[model samples]
Target: MNDILIQNTTAFFEKSFGSVPQKVVLSPGRINIIGEHIDYNDGYVLPAAIDKIICFAFEKNDSKKSKIIAIDLNEEFEIDLTQEVKLSKVVWTNYIRGVIKQLQDNGFSFEGFNCVFSSNIPVGSGLSSSAALECGMIYGIKELFNLDIQKLDISLLGQKAEHWVGINCGIMDQFSSVHGLENKVIKLDCNTLEYEYHNADFKDYSLILMDSNVKHSLFTSEYNTRRIECEEGLAIIKAEFPEIKSFRDCSEEQVLNLKNKMSEKVFSRVHFVVKEINRVVKACEALDQGNIEVLGQLLFETHYGLSQEYEVSCEELDMLVNTAKDDDAIIGSRLMGGGFGGCTINLIKKGHENDIKSKFSNLYLDTFGIELKFYDVKISNGTTLL
Candidate 1:
């Protein structure tokens, strides 16, 4: 897959620029093992970079004007570095423009360049394809320009770029894209940018992402609403318990106590975060002890909390996760990413993967008329030049 992607990107670059690309970057999408919707709440999220990636080829034009080609979408966008940064009308171009804008805003000046890119990351699947693009662009540019930037800064810049592009996302996607290590998961603190990598070697089990191929229109608005609701509940709790700093520090008892003061919606959101945060803690411990069965149960608990308590899930997602209860081979399964519609990350025994995929796909098609696409993913290194 890497070889084909590299060959295709290089060929496209040569065709577009009449010469080979000076640099290439591959940035992988991410998966959160347990914690969800807790990153902005100052909770730790365990995420790892996956094999799904966005590939890019870049070369300096040595001119103010730059052209970018989205090889997959067959779209072209052009910009001039000398001009003031403005948001692009084209949505995808904004990712490219956002990264460039972030670089300039940080006083990292460099000339415009030509780029061609392709991606295998499924769109709207909650794999964070946008982060892969943002990180890939910055990493390629940094290499092409010999810029003195650290990996952590690369993540922050990609995150800021997304905020500029109107996503208002947390840092997990970009952080995992830039800091991921092969065969490991990073236990990262969202508050202090502190992290440690844990071995992710599941001896007899494998990870797979089964995309529901269903996206609810309410995702963006509800995502913002979730953030606001969490903050409202957190403020209420902090007022009662002055020692409580964020949802990470707030106890389940404290949240339950303030349920009357806050609305049911806000209360549920806070309740989910508090419990989900503790689940992350236990999940790390479970992995440390190589007790994957405990980890799988924790994932199921998180799905319930997300679907019921947090109220971010839809009927399709509920149905998808519901099917897992019957299959003993399927240990862990949940609606991943921002909730409404996307993929469910599952951990199942190696031999039963095909049977599970076949069963799930047929069920989805019969029930919803949408095709279920499953991806077999491995823990892979972060963004790198190839």
Candidate 2:
């Protein structure tokens, strides 16, 4: 816990609401160590909560109305808990509103509350601050109301909240934020929701995010399109291969054997999903065997697939990964998240963090004339009361 930040948020809550908050929660942003776009394709992802976080302060009010404030945004929302929770015109509030609605829709009743939140997670750097916000609110509410909600259910409710807010996000983000453990990454089965934690001991290597700081307009629209494309390719394959349930059950060979029938685009999508799925499996094993080099190589392979086969990587993202590939100090690097311009997750020699950051930042500006940002993050525990 950062005492100063938490103390500030709590003080602001007291000044705004005229009383001390009953609960304060720390919800963390998450990073996928290896897996990326394969989450929606029934693939396993290795994600962990990071030190970056959203701190929420919650207090029950005597009345049936709720008041919420976004300390950083300088925004406040007021709503009657007994009435329908309509989608707010304010976009950020919708994430919180959706969480309240999820709880209310599921028959969990609680008193109206006042909340004040502030986040340290960079919004568009692909660290999943939205998930942190949603999960943090839900976890805080659970604590405040003393609700019978397990961590798994907290994650599910967070996912539903996101869907309610109109993002068709997979479970990886919420699960990682809700269930994260210190110095560990989760091997999450998106299909069954079963997961296992592996030690994330980078040893001499450090994990860094090189933010390209560019999000092409193609990101949101193409994200939905990719899901549809995966479904289209899978429906065709599953029709011929009766036993296949998802890409998890299917193989690279099967996807190849039917390549002639599939459209070139669909085939590429499926092939990437299949190969990426297997890559995650090997990645877990590599970590288990303490073969950081093998895991690093797998990161490079995943980037190639995301760029060439998945078609999600933009030029800036590709450059980030490609540059890391050539650097001897860097073991593995790949574009993280849905791509089309976000940060590339890089594993690099510990002593070289400064030099690499300087080299990459300068190179990026010279090549694209856009300022680059980088984050040094560490694995941390999931959402919990402060």
- Tell me how candidate 2 scores on lDDT: 0.92
lDDT score for candidate 1 against the true structure: 0.91
Clashing pairs in 1: none
lDDT of 2 by residue, 243-318 (tens): 9999989978889999998999999999999988899899999988889989999999999999999899999999
Q: Least lDDT summed over 10 consecutive residues: which range in candidate 2?
A: 1-10
- After the best TM-score superposition of candidate 2, give how far the Cα of residue 257 lies from its true spot, in angstroms: 0.8
Candidate 2 backbone collisions, by pair: none
Alpha carbon lDDT of each predicted model: 0.91, 0.92
Give stretches of model 2 more than 4 Å off.
none
Angstrom error of the Cα, residue 280, model 2: value is 0.8
Give the per-residue lDDT of model 1 (tens digit) for 2-77. 7798899899999989998999899999999989998888999999999889999999998998899999999998
Best by TM-score: 1
TM-score per prediction, in order, is: 0.99, 0.98
